[model samples]
Target: MRLFFPLLLSILIFSCTTKQKDHFEADIIIYGGTSAGITAAVQAKKMGKSVIVVSPDRHLGGLSSGGLGFTDTGNKAVIGGLAREFYHRLYLHYEQDSAWKWQKREEYGNKGQGTPAIDGENRTMWIFEPHAAERVFEDFVKENQLEIHRNEWLDREGGVVKENGEITSFRTLSGKIYRGKVFIDATYEGDLMAAAGVSYHVGREGNSMYDETWNGVQVGVYQHRHYFRDSISAYKIPGDPSSGLLPEISPNPPGKNGDGDKLLQAYNFRMALSRNPDNRVPFAKPANYDPARYELLARVYAAGWNQTFEKYDPIPNLKTDTNNHGPFSTDYIGKNYDYPEASYERRTEIINEHEDYQKGLMYFLSNDPQVPEDVRKEMANYGLAKDEFTDNDNWPHQIYVREARRMIGAYVMTEHDVLGAKAVPQPVGMGSYSLDSHNTQRFVTPGGFVQNEGDIGVHPKQPYSISYGTLVPKKEECSNLLVPVCVSSSHTAFGSIRMEPVFMILGQSAAAAASLAIDEGIAVQDLDYEKLRKVLLEEKQVLEN
Candidate 1:
């Protein structure tokens, strides 16, 4: 009987070993299925390299399809290469008469980002529906013949196998292993970068750290119309400190103007809403909806704040890409401080909390009796688009991760590079967007009123170049890994560099460098910049103004 039991145990061990022996090999392994990851895979294929994309998301385009249809493109001329091709394809899709299924082509307005939505001369479209954007990304994958494994999450705890400061392979939560010569961490959260023992920063760095302005906590500087115009009491019973501060407002005083803190910028879902009665799904109350949580918004409305519909930016077919607007609106400030480094279970909780809060805000404005009558009437015109995000019950599947773990690599992009005061060596791409950041926290001011802080907007003198060194890690950290989404940058500089188009550009450049490194048998940090620049220019990337 003992001999029989030992033989059974041996059989079980052999079966387990056989199952774990499967490993997929490639020249480059892209760890995200974001827009950047797709672009990187395409570029690597174009360079005659075998590549595979391991995506944690089921969706293709990150935020481009996840509800942020209103693109924040600062200067369109600087957008070239595959990024420009993506917008061009969007233009082609809208040219077809059948594309306008919900609304007539003539009825849809052509206004977006201070330009016409359909630019016939430039052959590009800036605004579109969520479904249309997703179609384009899927088309890219199909046309490129790229291999993508979706819904596969990386094992954050001890999943990365490294040998002498280089990643040999990585295992997923499902026990699937991928071996590659090079890796690109294209995720917005920088999960692969963090797992590979790379140095990164979480919260806002003090202005003194980079020796520039707008890098740290911003208290009194109000750059947009998001703050409260008039002083309003934060208490439940108005002006009585004994009643205690209302929900969502922090009791702690906002620190001095420029002092830094561990707080991060607020994150909210960019909802895709429709005004067309046929396509609109009325905002349903979330399962965990609580009306008392939005008491501060009711008070803001009572104080004559009525900008609820200001940010209902228009897209195609009468759909709107709705974002956070005004004081006490959608952004749940001070609630995401621990999200960057939290466990998967904790991150899911945070995402669910944001979804519930935003969903509840919509219901409160459209039906709550305490809300102002005129504001409620305006909000009643909008609802979730029935044709978008169908698998997730008409809600976006991806949350807007405004900022996350930023790698501190060989080169750190600071405010000097963003403001065009410093020359960037080994230029890979360009960014012209304003240095924009959302509010990080809502706290009581010294005057005993609620105020939102950490919002800053500073524009560059001209389109500035991003360095290639920002994409690769230091020689001592990891030799084969490249990070494009969370590139090395100060808080203020990353604001401008964090645009979607810029991410695509860097992704392509990172793949090009990776291919060159493999062909020359060199580390990513030791690749020839001149050769990379020649290839990037050949691919139509705009490196210099």
Candidate 2:
């Protein structure tokens, strides 16, 4: 009788635990808190499907809420559906008088990238503050009642459990397991896609691989103002090889133009600075500040380069969306080659290093006596926005992950799509931005002068359609996974497609396809494109216009 009672107790405990484990089943599982992830969750809810957002980040909206307030929306007419809706919501928020806190509406000039700040006819605002963008994303979560488990880091090594090429369940670092029918990898790094054994590509592809003009290593292509205008010695002491190269300068020579290499473009913090004295916080020097680290920048200034504040793109309320401008600025070139596949600890170290480099650059520009006087005066006028990103000492919580592990899915969007040389089958979204790639490496020329390489900016013919095939993995690899942010595209093509608004559009389309796949009991790749297109158009997604 004692053994019988104990056995019954054990059975009951097992059943209860099983029931608890099955509690989190959802129709769609979004694996990031990026803007794309939030949009996916919202779309899934609209389609009457249960959705959960399992994010590794503490905050939502990735770079959108991070410091990228000046939206890189090229040909905004191509933006439609939830992406346009988001901008409209921003327009509504800015319409209210209360939104203008530090600066008044008329006082702050209404200007944007060759357009008005507010597009009245389109009912959207292209520019905004970071906090306002975060609020809109938070509103989506609240209104949809999304189940988001923030700070839930995935167990990349042994977290995913698959059955017949389908992700049955995934366990987090905290030992919590989540099961879902369809999974969307909306992260910039494509972590879930990699975990699910999806095929992906990193770094630039050779131009010959895709018959692309700008796909590979560009050694002499100086398309932007971010390069040295004159010959600058790479050494700490001018014209001396024994003086050692300055910090961040690669000793290796840049490869042949249009050749392939594994180097990645530079990364920088898109800082939000306030010119308003009432709401400005002085840029604090990073904990590991080293003045000697910026000798290269000092040399650039000494060589008569003075366009430092050219990229302080303005946003609302007298705040500027500061980006990398000159030859030696915010970008930590050639320092993040392993970030796409690095361990968590390694990635954190890289992030901290980037933060230190940028902070040190700001300190050097604003306070150092070596900087040009006019440039120093202009930089001193700006400081971190006090009301922005209040959690991380007024700095952005998410780093700008420009391009990471791009899924090599069923169909890759190459330069032919951007140039209208090839027809895009099963259109999901559109991208119109230029093929813009920042410098990947700073190498010494054969003439013994420092120069930047891999910066290319080629504008597309027009707004081009992004294929649905670019979002799904190969059928043999993972049948149920969808990757929106890290879609299948070459490095140069991805530069055009890797914008926040386009990501939101792709996220909505991915959710729509996921819902259809669940309803039809088919794999994500096998879902009918005609049915998906009908639903997307019905939802006001502009596919062909």
Candidate 1: regions farther than 4 A off: 1-21
RMSD of each: 2.4, 1.6
Best-matching candidate per TM-score = 2
Per-residue lDDT of candidate 2, residues 186-247 (tens digit)? 99999999998999998998899888899788877778888888889888888888888887
**Per-residue C-alpha lDDT of model 1 across residues 198-247, encoded as one tens digit per residue:** 99999888888989889787888889887878888888778888888888
Judged by whole-model lDDT over C-alpha atoms, candidate 1 comes out at 0.90
Give candidate 2's error at residue 193 in angstroms: 0.4
